[model samples]
Target: MLYRFKSQATADLVMLVADAQGALRLIGKDLTPEGVISPDQLPWAIDILQHAWREDNDLGLREDTYATEQLAEQDDENPDVRLSQRLVPLVNMLELANKAQVAVVWSAS
Candidate 1:
């Protein structure tokens, strides 16, 4: 399954099932079929994502022992780079949506 998040403020952000689920979890959402993040909710979402990112980095999962084969070959990237990149846009999306008094929603496909 795939999860595609959308908002008028930005381009669509598509993520794998596991990745999407994990990110939703990070923002304290259960794995539901679909949901909306209101502008009122975005500030907390941003804080949650930021906190989770810091905690993930603190784990040092980018180290050789914890890294996967692909990461081993890319010395400059962290193990969570892909997840983080996928979500960075969300942070911005949430902020923009907030300013515009809009919402960001995700659908499963």
Candidate 2:
């Protein structure tokens, strides 16, 4: 599955299932077929995403032998990169949508 997040303020942001689910979970959103994030919610969502990103970075999972061993077994690409870097585009979309006073919507396909 793929998720496409759209906002009038920016280009649509597309993410794969694992990434989309992880990001939405960080922002307290459910993995529904479709959902909306109003402007009022954008700030809070951005804050949560940023905080999670920081926490993920501070943990330094890439350097941990245990974490590295686990990462090696996953089919996904670069756990370190996916954990935080993937959130950047969505966060940027939320910020832009907030500035424009528009809602961001997402649908799964």
Top lDDT prediction, candidate number: 2
lDDT of 2 by residue, 52-106 (tens): 8888766765456677687688858554365777888988889889889999999
lDDT of each: 0.77, 0.86
Which residue runs of candidate 1 sit more than 4 Å off their true CA positions?
61-85
Q: What is the lDDT of residue 99 in candidate 2?
A: 89
Which sections of candidate 2 miss by over 4 Å?
61-80
Overall local distance difference test of candidate 1: 0.77
Query: In candidate 2, which residue pairs get closer than 3 Å at backbone N, Cα or C atoms, i.e. clash?
Result: none
C-alpha root-mean-square deviation, candidate 1:
4.4
